[model samples]
Target: MISASAAVLRAGDRPYAIEEVILDEPGADQIVVQVAATGFCHSDAVARAPKFVQVWPLITGHEAAGVVERVGSEVSGIEVGDHVVLTFAYCGTCSQCADNHPAYCETFVQRNILGLLATGGARATAAGDESVGARWFGQSTFATRTVVDARSAVVVDRDLPLDVLAPLGCGIITGAGTVLNVLDVRPGTSVAIFGVGSVGLAALLAAKAAGAESIIAVDLHPARLELATELGATATILGGDNDSVAEQIRKLTNQGTHYSIDTTGVPEVILCALGSMRARGVCASVGIQTGDVVLDGHALSGKQLVSVIEGDADPRTLIPHLIQLWRDGRFPFDRMLERFPFTAINEAEKASLEGRAVKPVLVMS
Candidate 1:
């Protein structure tokens, strides 16, 4: 057994104080990780909201980087002290995995969303033997130490800083993969990205790398728009005013953008982006939005629209490619990060929601 400090959400709307939690040793097909850093994503907030009552007292977090401190006997290719990134868990025997699409594995909802350990039980607990649900996205990495399935951990270069690379697990991969893999963006393609957060900025960078002729970035924050331009957006649209945003996008792309991606998850922004697409143009929605999306059937039929999960990428392949791009200095994802100590997780979350920080990484001692 090991003791670690973890941020626990015990039936509250927000994450409360960090408490000492107990972690068990790795079992078969499992590995113990000493977390170096974890990215504070907005999705963590959504998961804690009332909408997600399925899992309670869950240790929340997904994007993370760490070092393998111990490995189960059944695990292979990974060893102690190996640097790694913890990705969303998947049951490799599912049909989706058989087809080489683990991201869409049918068991993803069970393995990752439900926070079940590989042993099919809880991996963490409080002092009184009460469950402090772990295994969220297979890592529950809000804590200083995590035990995860060996399959969920991807070994990365030890030379890279964990804080800087942690975001690559989710947000970064979702955005970049949507453009490079899902859309298969090519030279001369006209693309418009709605919501210039970490994800949208990643799409912009990928589009530029693919030689897109025009890259349009739509966002309310002037600072984000400026960053979008610096990252590779050919044009910027202030989306605060809904009516004019589409018009400005149309003006920049002439008839309309050939490919449009919505990362904001705002209903209005999704609709605007759909309307901004040329006839039969592809529109990919990568944002996490709840509630019903109301849209005209005929409008959607006229323009092809599709939703992508994990940017339609296999993390094993896409993450390495993104890291290579970063090494080449073509993808400056580090510029989007704002680091904070793990103790200040609440502050980091607030900063992200208030637009004060584009992306926040919580460093663990």
Candidate 2:
């Protein structure tokens, strides 16, 4: 096993501690990636909370971009020195994967969420040989290094900056995928995006690219709303600016938006997003919910709510598309980024948790 400095999560509601850990070599079909950069996403943050299985001593950053340091004997089409982005783990042999929906791969929860690596053992350990949970979402990129199944990585052009493209694995893809890949959005369609965070803003950008006619951005943070407006939102609404956010949205769109998306998992906000859509309109939620979302029986007459993961995208295809979009100056998601040294992980996490930053990318020193 090789040594690397890693952020160890030992408790819920506690800060990450930098500690030296033992990292194992890649088994066949897996590769050792010297992580170049990684993004902080809400899904990674949720592992710290107690609701889920509190697998302590876990290494927990998933949005990874790195270079291949070692290639597995069984892996192909990838080689050393390739720049890659780590995506959600999927047992590629599963039916869902065969259907081209790796996001919903049958083993998604077992592989990605459960922290189960290909070898069914810890890839990292503590000083005295204590098992440390590794492979969180197939990479656990919180450290300076990681080992991942070959299928979880997508090689990108070397010229692309890893800092900004890192988030495409999850956040950016979720938003854009839901818009361009999942929903029936088209040119001149009225759409509204709620929350205006990474996911929401990504949706805004995608909607603009899709030629959405009226894209309304809703959020409590005026700054995020303004940023959304600058990105592509035709209008912005302050969270407290109206008695009813749905009413404001409906009134603004004449009847209501033809479609809407909620990146804020707040149940109330989710309901509002559902309410803000026109008849037969669809609403998608990318946020982690705090509680149940109950809909009005009448509102359910034609409106539909869909829960999506990883934007329902096949990473291999979607990530490359995003790269092309970025190259064409269509998707400028980099404007929402801020960089931090890998050593300042705790401070970075704080900035992200408290809403002080939109997309905090940690650079490996």
Model number with the top lDDT: 2
Clashing pairs in 2: none
- Over 308-352, each residue of candidate 1 has an lDDT whose tens digit, in order, gives 888877888888898989999988999899999999998988899
Overall local distance difference test of candidate 2? 0.87
TM-score result, candidate 1? 0.95
Single out the weakest 10-residue window by summed lDDT for candidate 1: 114-123
Give each model a TM-score.
0.95, 0.97
Model 1 Cα shift for residue 124 (angstroms): 0.5
Question: Best TM-score goes to which candidate?
Answer: 2
Candidate 1: Cα lDDT at 76: 96
